[model samples]
Target: MRSGVSRRTFLASAAAGAGALAGLLPRPLRAQDKTVKIGFLAPLTGPVAAWGKPGLDGCQIWAEWINAGGGINIGGEPHRVEFVAYDDEDDPAKARTGATQLIRENDVKFVMMLGGNSWPGVQPVAERTGMLFSTLLPSDLSPSTATLIAPAEVHPIYNVTAVDWLAANRPELKTAVICAQDDALGLPSVATYLAAFEAAGIEMLDEPLLFDPATTDFAPVVTRMLSKKPQIVCLDTCYSDYVHPICEQLFQQGFKGQILSCTLDFYDQVIAKTSAEFMEGTLFQFPDFDDPALNADFINFQKPNEFFAEYNRRHPGQWGAVSWEYASVMDLWKAAVEKAGSAEPDAVKAAMTEGGEGLHAFGKARWWGKDLFGIDNALVGNWPVVAIEGGKARIKEFRSIPDWYDKHGELMKKHMAAYNQMWDQRG
Candidate 1:
């Protein structure tokens, strides 16, 4: 909002919080030597920690960048950002404790979560305090939540883009199989893939495969999928920790077929377990940060090009679901804070949903998803269909999600009903 702060420049600098962010508090709001703090509530010690910690590191980079650039200008005064962190460990009870700790003890204004089960626990605390809460999981959105947003992703909705691409490109694959953990994120993905695969005209050769995270042997799981003889297999919202073992078994069984997933993080490990040839042609939603299409079409990142170079440099082979996602949310937050000229949660929420096109981490997009999620919190736009070629992953196209929603609205609702996870019940 200030002459010195370009939207692009502000987003880029505030994305990673590379500095301590302790010096970025608004001078007027500063209580003596104290600083402004934002809370990063994530699973830092559970099975999901790998997903949470990397994004926090990115947030650290963003805070540092903003603070270094003379901080954010609010009403002609400068404010630095300080990130206060708490580990929810992907558990409900711990998340509530962390939420209270950050709000009551630390007095943070904004709270970011890796979301999922952890979100349910912290939602009340966020509402009571009127603090801005961000979740990478759009399933966390609802009318009841006046302060929550899924600024970066609509995980399963984007996964449909891959299925759409595959349906048009690989018509020979007429049937498929699916496997997913029986959790919050997993259930919706199962419903989504069922709708996607069906809309693609791919028949299900077998019933959906459900795996327990505690289960150690995936050879049996792969054996079951092989028995169905599906031309394709869907890894519906699986954890990275599970993807390797499942893909390993798929390789050991030598089942060559089309594969789809919501993510393929640390897929290099998957390539090693399988062969480069076997891993090739796999489809997913996420993309490599350096994808050329992003540079040409998007203005959502701090510096998409430079950020990619630095991220890969600092933490090689580790980008996944929440890697740049949380930081991207921070960028949107900065824009909204500027638009509203305040950090109040209600003001930010109203600004986000004022009904025009909004800028998300992925280029400029429309704020949509009320029909699907019971709230318009997801930033809908062109999502990449990433595929593995000769073991190297690359984006093949940026497909429009709006068109697909137009065609398959009823089918998706049916799938959601089957899973008892209509947007109203996402919590």
Candidate 2:
């Protein structure tokens, strides 16, 4: 690993050259000596780029802010933060290469991943090196993977909160049909929604309809789902690429009912494709950072409204569910590094999960998920349930995830088992 501190003599050399010369240097100049590099391995190009690129933008803002504030103080010495990024393009082979390169060649203390299709490729390398890594997907956690953590977003597990909120508010919607692409993301979400619906007393019209990832024609999928005459159409964790096309087909077909999804990114575009009336009342997770609820005391992102503004200004119409997630993970990481007094991967990992507790973006949360994922690496707490009211995504409420888990955890485990999604069951 590269040394964080620059090799420049200060107090000793100055003392020898002239008495009391060291005190003359400006404070900022003396503090700007060391650099700490972190790795960002995620897709910058491809179907999932929306989930990856905006995160990079947010991290850039975070690094700049930390540096401006004289960097993070580590054992009384401040070190400038730097991010080294690689575009994995959502490919497993490329993910493996990127992970190895980031850890071996660049020597990053920690790596952040978008964590879906490419995680399997990166997992072995991460385990071999004992590199501290953060993923947005808690599904990626397992007991064997000690240094991996899902500190920010918990993905499909959080989808339950939305369903719980929906059942409470719109209890009349009974039957639902679901469809998703056959992949790492789609399957687990299908299981989660299945459990949520079952717990909510919403009956399924049919088994989950799995489509190929390369499928372009959503007409058949939409037609089949609508044929069941279900009141709710669940797009169980489909990619943004798939969500738009399926939603367009649903709108074009004029099969009107509630639409539930894990993310409705760039909903403005979807609203344009479909009518505002058609998009209204749609339920999903992930709130816009500028939402008034983000100002709540439980919220941790600094000036979330300003961050949202800057993101939109720089990368217009591109922010999505994962826009701020990577930066939030960075927030936890920075705090842990400072507390550990070192950036060594092991030390940081220990500090991060010091007491099986963490400051999740939403609020104070505990490390959980041993029953579902066979590991307690996920930070479980309150997650928001968002609905489109007048074509804008608004947080309806902050639902407690642990509370939901407490009520229906066994049902969730049964559904996950049906899908063979338990960590030990995974290869």
Candidate 3:
């Protein structure tokens, strides 16, 4: 775009013959170009890195595609987008430090995070600076947090769709047990599942099991859960770390019941640990990109199958829960920036929520969740109910999240209140 001339060299040339060159060059070419810095603050290392790093990898591919297509056009000038990532290690202290550094040092206009455990660390910075940010978790949403939005995967809440689908399709499974590691991510999810199960008329075999994050052996947990002899097992949004061991335990303990989870990341490994037969009919929320349903008209992600293949190629055996989520947010942000004619945070934020409608990768979703999470920042639309049929992940159905919420909003609020998760109650 600089015509092979360095900025300094171009400035020198312009100064010497400004009028002649300016008259000949196109207006866009004559304007000074820029590389817009977008900060990526997530765990690229440490225990929860699988959930963080793969999304960053997908973002790299998104950046490449945008740049190759001549970058994002803002105010008639093409500006290349560059991502500056910080490894927060999924730690609160490190997340705060990373947020401060990205804001003060990198001067990024937007910051994307994996959210959940790390959200509290960056909350202050986001409030103080009014910096626009995107999170995967809508539980992180609150009225006071004006600049943050969840335009991609709406976690836990969408988990309701999976439960709803299972209840409709597999009505014979009447009793269930739910379990999660007791933390920000797990607690909200546990509450959501509790509400979903109640709405579907599924009886709880016991109170939802809570475990420490440092938990290693899941034999005891599985043993206790199986003692109840639940017709269904709900792994209520456990991290991929816990999902594996808990699933393996279920197999080893020889408990045969419907297994449900908020996610089944790298499920092939789970199948390997247990068996293809064992994983059959296992239900969860997230979908594999190669699924035929992704070709639907409402799906906005560009070349999802290609993206998934390339991600696997570059980071073998590493793709997990968040592999496509952060990149999906990038797509929304880029569109907002172009529409607003500036990359400034406030302008883009306004543009993104202009009509309370967003092009969520799944489809056109509305900015909902104010009544539930105290903010209408999460993009709510249809979500896929994924099932492992014959050891392959397949879309059982695409359920309308808003439709479900309309009927069961009260149930969700009740459970969220019971968990003391309603924004105003977080004291």
Candidate 4:
């Protein structure tokens, strides 16, 4: 693996070459041939790499597409986009180091993070540097983190849409068992599922089974969850590493039930381990961009079908929940930079939330989260409910997350408090 300095040097060289080529064009066309760097500070080589590495890949495509046309227009000048990535390995101390380096050395205008345990490490740096940052997890938001935003992928909050869809469509499955690794990512999702199940009137078969992250064997865990004879099994945001083996155990134990989760990343591998028949009808929150639903008139993402095909061509069989999230953030950031007529963090952020709403990947969503995160920084709106059928993932429906919150917001707060997951409690 290349050192951080080496990677930066390579990217700088590539950016210089691109700029040189631009300079060859007519003088009027090369009005302002400059480069803007964005920071990808996340776990690129760890248990969480599934979420981070794929996102950087997608951002690469996004930058190529934008630069091929005309780069982001700021103050009537075009600036090429480049990415500088630093792997935090999901460690807080490493995250802090990465954030400082990306800001002071790389001079990134924006930074995107997976943002669970890593947020704390980056928060202080953001406070000090005033650099704009975006997180996939809205649970990381707080009133003090003014420069931080949840422009895409609301994480546990969006999990409610899946439960809502399940209860309305398959009401027969009234009882559920939930299991998750007890950690920053898992606990909040467990609370969200609890609130969602409660709102939908589905009974939790047992106290959520919180297991240690290091536990390699899942037989005993699955045995305990199955002891209650639940008609539904909810895997509350476990890492793909854990989700896959637990699924294999469910199949080995000969259990047939409706399986729900926050993600089914790399589900094809799970199907291979078990069987396609055994993996059918599993419900999760993310959709493959190739899904026709993304082409709806209200959807804001550009060229979803082509993006999916290009992504698969470049990185075969590596798509996951975050494959497009960071790229999606870039889409919003580019628009904001253009709208504000500058790439400065403060100006771009002001433009992003100027009207109290933003263009989410699904549609226009309100800038909300004050009641939950003690800050109105998360872009809340509709989220998709997906199911695996006939060996492929399909978007079953796009459900309103804001509508669900309006109906059960208090219930969600109660559950979040119970699990010490509310913003205040976390602080």
**Judged by lDDT, which candidate is best?**
4
lDDT of 3 at 3: 18
- Candidate that would win on TM-score: 4
lDDT on C-alpha atoms for all candidate structures: 0.74, 0.80, 0.80, 0.83
**Tens-digit lDDT track for model 3 on 117-223?**
89988898899999998887888899989998988878778989988988888899899999999988889899899989999999998999999877877899999
Error of 3 at 217 (Å): 0.8
lDDT of 1 by residue, 56-170 (tens): 6667788777666556654555677788989898887899999899988988878888788888888788778777788777877777776777777777778788999998888
Cα TM-score per model: 0.90, 0.90, 0.90, 0.91
What TM value does model 4 have? 0.91
lDDT of 1: 0.74
Q: For every candidate structure, what is the RMSD over all alpha carbons to the true structure, in angstroms?
A: 6.9, 9.4, 9.7, 5.4
TM-score of model 1 vs. true structure? 0.90
Question: Residue 336: error of model 2 in Å?
Answer: 0.9
Residue 363 alpha-carbon offset, candidate 3, angstroms:
1.1
Candidate 4, pairs of clashing residues: none
Alpha carbon lDDT at 117, candidate 3: 84
Give the per-residue Cα lDDT of candidate 3 at 29.
29
Q: Looking at candidate 2, what is the lDDT of residue 224? A: 96
